[model samples]
Target chain A: MSTSTEKEMWVTKLRKGWQKNLPVEKLLPDTQPAYVASWIYLFGVATLASLGLIIATGLWLSFEGASWYHGSNVGHFVNSLHFWSVQFFFVFMVVHLWGKFWMAAWRGRRMLTWITGALAFVGSIATAFTGYLVQSNFDSQWISYEAKDGFNSVGIGSRFTVTNFGQMLLLHVAFLPVIIGIITLIHVLLVRAKGVVPPIDAFNKELGERK
Target chain B: MGIFDHFMNLRAVYIHLGWFQISITNLIVVLGMLVLFGLALFLPFPGNKKKGQK
Candidate 1:
């Protein structure tokens, strides 16, 4: 339905948009400001690494059945790795969140970055909660049984009943992880587009660090 | 909070009054962080208070 020139023009326009918003130099920066050299910035990378570990280990656990995790030693090791990564992911994410909050990292119209990061944190928590429910053990049973009442009290028991193992497993293995991945990618892209926020002192003398 | 096993051991503030059963642990941690962050932006640097007093 479109002419060739018009189609090419649209493609060129999109390319220009990407270049202006997130040039390759900023997208893959070789250097950052000196002020970024602190323990806080490191937590972001650590958190991301922990997330990667969790997903990698989760894939293995999902592939092998109950016999492998409980029967085979390697499966047990991988299962442990996944569990520990979930713990570390939360730990690192919270530390990073605290650091950013202290720095007001959302300054200079970076609110979307902050918002996406917060949403991803929440999605990760939901994913972890489902992971515990999908364990297929006594612990899972107890948690799932206990969780039913809470869901019913809130009147969403019918749609998202944790007592249903099949539904929970499907959601844990697929749906939630996809949501978390997409949101995290958006958060990272927003950070790249916005660049890191400068310190308050760098902005003004009197306003100083108050900002 | 005791109903949720993992959270049971977390030393969370719990309230059970009639139909309302809530744990303030999550609330406190989230709000506490925000409050501390807000305070950091103002205090330890002679900033503003009640306008007439400052």
Candidate 2:
């Protein structure tokens, strides 16, 4: 392994990155602090699980296309599951965000983690908005008309019209999902790179500064 | 008591409390949001953070 002050090399940088930021013991910890048994700490994992369900049901929906989903009983069941999963994702993620914000989770060189998490929350809103616009129903049409004025007021409607079925459908299934996926990926990586932030009072324990 | 003859004509499910009435669906949504808010405020976190016992 290259020392911290060693001369630069691409391969050495990769080795140093893992050594300094993500040692295997920290990256995949088997034993969590006893304090980790609480429910709120699991919100991140809950949201992740909900996202997995959402994507799984979504792929099933995309495969069946709009006809089956709108017409068939089984498709409706899967759609309902997808809807509930999205609701769970938001509930868990928002609560998690609220918990982190109150805790000032940015402490301990974790600003990037907080930023990525916040961006993911915002990206989720856009993804959901496109999702509603692409629903292919009277409700969606009404929502598109209602939402267009707000987008126009912000000068974004001309570029991304909610009424454009083709554009909105593509955005919902492709663009927004991709953006959300990237943000979520970065957020998780940041959390892994910086080990879970301990409770403030735990700082008084044998916790040394992160190296 | 309401007439049983009109039972099949009923579509609106109402919960009556003295002077006020609300639909079951609206009640569920409102109560659900309140419950969610309460959970958000009081959910137990690691380190007993909710009670400052850490």
Candidate 3:
């Protein structure tokens, strides 16, 4: 009974500290509202949705057994879903990148957010490369040989083997996802912390012009 | 590395030349692009602002 009471007391203390550090008031934005946007703004959300589909389809494919995926109808459908997910992933990523570029979103203490996202984009390419190799199909074999030369030329062949199924699978399924997920979390946190930048005119106009 | 080795290495090019291979490759590429498009709906990349005005 005493031990349980002490545990409860510790929990209460932890809760109090959390409340003090992250009050609702502190979390609220001090700046402009975030809903301002055109239809293009929806692209980012679409990208995330596609990623969800990819993960779902990938899980289904993973359960089908490797050899089954190559010849079975159910496996084919799952593979199709995974394939389409990847296609949409790149499209959404490109659109989102282009949108961000046009917005000059790196300004006003938000530069690190932009840089981390750019790095995530680079990491995504690596993830995609591994995904291609893990297919274990004819194309996989052919691409592996072709890609090896490029990798070797860059001196990365010593450490990163494209033909290694175990390594590629682990990296694609585990390592890359963790990195991508963490970067995405950090990106979202930074956005929430900084709040959205107001319209350029809001900051650029003279004092007399201010409404 | 003689011309023969180069030719042997390029044997994969013949594989690409096959209609079946070409179709499969195109299918994969198209599907990949489609997936990227679908994803764009959700995880939008934040954009940069216009130049010189920030």
Q: What residue pairs clash in candidate 1, if any at all?
A: none
Q: Residue A108 error for model 1, in Å?
A: 0.4
Better of 1 and 3 by lDDT: 1
Q: What is the TM-score of each candidate against the true structure?
A: 0.75, 0.77, 0.67
- Please give the clash total of every predicted structure, in order: 0, 0, 43
Question: Which digits, one per residue and each the tens of the lDDT, describe model 3 over residues A1-211?
Answer: 3366465677678777757744565466443355344444556667778877877887777677555677776686678778879887877777777767777878788898898779878988888888898898898888889998888899998889887788888787878878877887677666666665555566546655765
What is candidate 1's fraction of native contacts?
A: 0.00
**Candidate 3 Cα deviation (angstroms), residue A178:** 1.5
If ranked by TM-score, best first, what sequence of candidates would result? 2, 1, 3
Q: Candidate 3, residue A106: CA error in Å?
A: 1.0
- In the range B14-49, model 2's lDDT, one tens digit per residue, is 999999999886687657645665675577654533
Model 1 docking category = incorrect
Question: In candidate 2, residue A139 scores what lDDT?
Answer: 70
DockQ ranking of the models: 2, 3, 1
Candidate 1 chain A, run of 10 with poorest lDDT:
A31-40
